[model samples]
Target: MSTMTVKRAELKPGEVLCSYCTARCCRYFALPIETPETWEDYDHMRWYVMHGSCAIFVDEDVWFLMVYGDCKYLLEDYRCGNYEDRPQICRTYTTDECEYDNDGTYDRLFETPEQIWEYAHAVLPPKKKKKKKKSATEVSHQKLPIVHI
Candidate 1:
């Protein structure tokens, strides 16, 4: 099927930009999530990506989990079916920072579980190596106790 796209540069003065959009914003929803610091936190993010067409992104130092699900009120014509009664969040969405105005790019975006895992491995500190246990005879003859600092 053919689709129409209007560039921000070509928009005429005072013209509504959303009318020319394919409802990009309506096709996805993003909610802020806790920043992944530890491997476990990133593992949770990886789990989210494994579920479906979801993405984890870091934008402006904030992390978010984006799910690709079209709004039920989205019409075939790329308009809101319930425009008048749309929710407050949708109503407050401005075209200024919309996907229509510019490309929707994040600081760091991960679409697959492997990407999150790779990122976690790259940033997180290496795991400490485990010390081997001493033999029973060696331990019994040791002069000093093993002290972990």
Candidate 2:
């Protein structure tokens, strides 16, 4: 919601969006994860977020694990050092989906392990407790077979 921002479709002639960007996309990478189906799955997500440099986010019903790290090829001037030899993924990127001027907040963001666990507790059913097993000394009563003193 930047007042001084212009959408891609509304950009004036001879304007490049990447020049105005601070290389936001180069600062992090996000990978989609399977929807958490069980408490253990949620716990796994919690573990991922606990690493300190990553987070869990839900956007448009899809879950993603966002890892924050600068690409080694990124230069100090916010430009890629290997632009000529960049990977195919970077070559295929387009500005249409860029978040340079747009607010890139996800629908739901979990930045801490406790936040993920709390979400699991809120959505998942209570964990079932296991029944305690009786010891051998607590066997059922029966006729005494011992005869020797």
Candidate 3:
């Protein structure tokens, strides 16, 4: 994609500039991963993060799992439809300090499933549990037995 550049002030010049960007950051797809304390949780995240276009990022104190996608209003030229009344967050955002600038500044950034798996494995040992099998007689025996006094 061609990088479109505008003056630093032009980033938030009135509402038009923000609208022009069409809230690209907010529009991108993302979901939160439940707190990953256990290996299984991290393993689940590994599968999720490995899918095409997927990325995991953390900001401030929160973790976000994301997939890259464009905004519905991002025109062929990358402009917004309603520039005048764009959301306040977009209006206030400055490209000077943005993802486009630093790419992303997550405290921890996991770019791939392998990266997540490695982190999980390094911290947690691989332990698998065996499933217990129950036969029909065993199942019936566990039920309340008839009391014939």
- Candidate 1's residue-wise lDDT over 66-149, tens digit each? 999999988898888899999999888898878775667889999999999888889999857789999999988889867999
Query: lDDT tens digits, residues 1-149, model 3?
Result: 23565544655536334333435665576677666789878877888766767788777767788888776566666666666877886689666565543455678788888888887878786767778898898988796878999
Ranking by TM-score: 2, 1, 3
lDDT of 2 by residue, 1-92 (tens): 13355567776788777766678889999999999999889989988987799999999999999999999999877788999999999999
Q: What is every candidate's alpha-carbon RMSD to the true fold?
A: 5.4, 4.9, 6.1
Q: Top TM-score: which candidate number?
A: 2
> Runs in model 2 with CA error above 4 Å?
1-10, 133-149
Clash totals, every prediction: 0, 0, 0
- Model 3, poorest ten-residue lDDT window? 13-22
RMSD of 3: 6.1
Model 2 / residue 134 / CA error / Å = 5.3
lDDT of each: 0.87, 0.86, 0.69
Order of candidate numbers by lDDT, starting with the best: 1, 2, 3
